[model samples]
Target chain A: MKKTKHKILDMLLKHPDIHLSGQKICDVLGCSRTAVWKHIKELESEGFKIEAIQKKGYRLLSTPNELSEARILVGLKTKELGQHLIYFDSIGSTQKETQHLAEDGAPHGTLVITSHQMTGRGRLGRTWSMPKGKGIAMSLILRPKLSINRIPQLTLIAAVAVYKAITEVTGIQTDIKWPNDILVMGKKIVGILTEMQTEGTNVKAVIIGMGMNINANKNDFPEEIRHVATSLKTLTGKEHDMSLIVQTILFYFEELYLRYLEEGFSVIKWMWESHAVSIGKRINARLFNGKVLTGLAKGIDEEGALLLEDDQGSIHKIYSADIEIE
Target chain B: MKKTKHKILDMLLKHPDIHLSGQKICDVLGCSRTAVWKHIKELESEGFKIEAIQKKGYRLLSTPNELSEARILVGLKTKELGQHLIYFDSIGSTQKETQHLAEDGAPHGTLVITSHQMTGRGRLGRTWSMPKGKGIAMSLILRPKLSINRIPQLTLIAAVAVYKAITEVTGIQTDIKWPNDILVMGKKIVGILTEMQTEGTNVKAVIIGMGMNINANKNDFPEEIRHVATSLKTLTGKEHDMSLIVQTILFYFEELYLRYLEEGFSVIKWMWESHAVSIGKRINARLFNGKVLTGLAKGIDEEGALLLEDDQGSIHKIYSADIEIE
Candidate 1:
């Protein structure tokens, strides 16, 4: 946080591949060798892994880590998504962080990521397990000029992007699970969390928090979740490129998001239908009102709610509920 | 925050009329006079004013003359609203505090109030002035079961509640300046800043930051803001009770919120229309695309968007824009 340390950081970041000698750094910083060592110690504390050789110099090594600011910024290379990234090694939740960031005037495209979240949560504050370094947990901040009715489409767009990104990078054949999750072979591979800040008729910010099971082994999941949860490495038998996948997600997202703003949902409606799990299948949507409608999954309505037609021909627009394939 | 302090608070709330001596408080709390003195000093630091005489002993005088924690919770009785009110004498902003709290899983109804805001803001990050002891600057944490589409209504409901509370308590008869401001006699008196923390589809918490000019004088307003901003005392020519106004706002909100859940927009729509400066007026809406549409206000749609009917009878829903009365 001091000026000398900030100068050292600037030097390292500017010359990513350069090695700086302790003598040179100490002389340039006008500090003792102990002070230079302390500055490096501070950088290490910030999750920058640097190797100090006796004769050669200090070489900055990019470590494969979770919730490291450098790692997140390295992966996220969009004008919007990477502008600001906040990382927490163990947080209550990433969605909560992004929401807080949005509230504090963190502009559209601010990102929050966390790994090894002790109290990670899902919808309705349900426990969201985030094993150490086994998944890519990230959230995106977006301030769009959108009305309330058009907000649900953001979920659909995110689901589509995640599914596309995972499939493109890992070849996992992901499917849209409606409203919020991504599935592969009847098991959830990814979960999306969307939180918003609104004022009157305008959306203050919409944060899209995503959790993807990337490198977790079967043992990584708890016994209760082993049946319903899966990882990219577990599915594919090899580690997929996380940075590449992140890039593809941001790229596809920017495209989809722009389309969503300029042209509405038609651009990706057919794509979503193709990747969706229950398009033509008979499914039972358990409504919160205690009404169970066993119907064929027709398609998504213009407002992004799932449209289901029953055997008797009554069309039901389900806003939010547990979706079960029968 | 300490056990004995909470005990004293409980005693004060339970017995508001009677005064308690230090010895009696010591007896009630099972502590020594020195311990009571230490606790009193700690409470004083937290802004709880206590009177101690040579023979009369100690009596809880006024809450530390602060909008901070002590005074915020003194007479506060709420099942939800401000159940956990954190007062900051001077903060970057209450929205920032609430955001941090939300990220740390602050309870759904947690409230943050600041005596003076260093970085108070309005919609789209505009500046909002918050001078000490002259305004009620607070933010409430709420978790609404909104699908992003219904999120905007919360602001309108808050605006209506603010208008009603200001007029009823201060007798100012303030007019709703559409969307989020309350104006008294064509001068701005209150500004509502609603910020939310949300992820993909789940809303974690919305911090409703409101800055209401309470006892500000004419000289208190900055030269630039003098023409625009006015306080309750400035309009009423006398200082008004802030606690009464706070209670009134919360009461109206609870009622309007209940009615909103039961009957939807119909409950508060007319109320907003009655106090608003938008309906049936000729206004020019400055669109983000640099296009301005001059139209007569029809009313708000179901999703709380401004419904504008042009002279040609074309209905347009204005989402985000600056509407000026022409």
Candidate 2:
């Protein structure tokens, strides 16, 4: 369907700031010049500005900030991650679609990205708001050969990778709140929800859903979470390019995932500790069973479990819990 | 589709030795007498011998030992398990279909059963053969509010439940092989593969696939597994009714599952220890990573984790491994 347009766009992106002849594109893509013109017009309608000179062919001026499949695949320099991506103008949830795809044996690194999520989900089955064209609602399918017990480490690794991408791309100092939350200026800017399909101890596939408030303004957040949630636009007062941010995240994710596979979680653990905001801070963790324990957040252990030291000098390994800082 | 036939068969089984008039059967099922007669003919075609008395109506003389939905549901006594059963004459894999059903919000205890599986899967992605009309290939859907770490306990619990069902129904002595295999006379009789869909620590659904060689003969198994696998028919020199076995397994599963929910895994642990064949014996555990460790298998802990004492007296918590007694 849109694959031909993506192929043409890929050619233009490969040689950025240079004019590409329609005849050359038609020859390479094995399509007629009229087909190339139609695809270019379609791309233009989807927010891509293609500059056409009198006889100098066409040039790509700028790509829209929308997380389109063609835009995300422009310069996606990954071996497997984000290799086969599914883009939606609006969807209920990328997580739901990715789960189906994973069940159908979609290859590793298959990604589902949507411009708007009508029903976004957060950790612990919480509702997350993703305004249209304001945030990145994406889910990545990963098939890691790891035991079920070591799955928590993946959340930490993903948090670290996303944090690094945010800092490198937007130059924003984002901190990770243990497990899977990225915060900026003491407010949450990103939320990650990880789901898995397992056969006993063998993990078949892991779907990591990440919702980041990329171009959202302060008013975009709901009334209740407005005080506690923030976005990249609100923090920087500028609209960031989502395609660039998505590319950066995918790049970092592939690198970190490969490194984690080769060297294990030690490196990821170290990196996660460097950006963690709750370490050495007094906090109250409300566990899944509705029990709250006040403790000092003493950093994560080798398996990426939070080591919380209570007042009685006893340390508890918190697996899944909501934390509140004091 | 087959609901009407199943309903008619249910009525016939309810009044086993009594002759029910066609008008009465039609009135009870809200169908015409012609429809009732057609359904009886269909049931007869499926290997049921219904003696037609001149004016007294129809009497059930005998029933073929087929694992049909109506036969399995005839005397099913359970709160939740097997309340909804999907029967298939033959299928590629019951687990695959059950996973799809579970993803589509199939309720707890929904059962997917097939008379044969063209490509049955064993633990660790091994192949399991199930000949047509010779064994029971079924998958049960469960949505338990348990953590991912405790999922291994469910596999152990299922093994115990199935072992009890096999012993009670067939009066055959079977021993539980560590995680999910039933052995009789040192030959495998049943295999259980438990899979889960989870989000962080919350379990969405657990699909337990159990393939038991109920009425298979010696030649029904493949050449490779023929020596290692034995069926009830091969052991007892007589065919066993699969519907009775299926009903018994579901009944025991519901009882044990409810008990597990109310009392935790202690009772299941004790029962599993009582039937375990490897405990207190020297065994070789082949882990997923291709590591073979020979150790003395102690009884399971409260969480149903195998305690394997190595040569150094160091105990290793065996989460998932294929055990072979020495």
Clash counts for the predictions, in order? 12, 0
Model 2 residue runs over 4 Å out of place are A1-7, A24-35, A185-187, A217-230, A234-237, A262-267, A311-313, B1-11, B23-42, B307-316
lDDT of 1 by residue, A17-108 (tens): 87888888888778888887888887788667788888767767754333345443543546676556666666767776666667666877
Per-candidate TM-score against the hidden true structure: 0.79, 0.90
Error of 1 at A239 (Å): 3.4
CA RMSD of all predictions? 6.3, 3.3
What TM-scores does chain A show, candidate by candidate in order?
0.81, 0.96
lDDT of 2 by residue, A1-326 (tens): 33788899988777777799999999998999999999999989988988998678889888887666788786688988888888888999898889888977898999999869999888766788976888999999999988777777888888988998888888988999988899988998899998999998789999999999989888888889998888899989998888888888999989998999899888888889988999999999998788999999999987777899999999999877899889
Candidate 2 lDDT, B1-326, residue by residue in tens: 33677787877877888998998888888999899899899888877889888678887887777776777876788877988888898999899889888866799999999887898898867888977789989999999988777877888888888888888877998999988889998999999999999887579899999999988889878888887899999999887778888898889888888899899988888888998999999999998789998899998887677899999999998887888999
Q: What is the lDDT of residue A15 in candidate 1?
A: 62
Accuracy of chain B in candidate 1 (TM-score)? 0.85
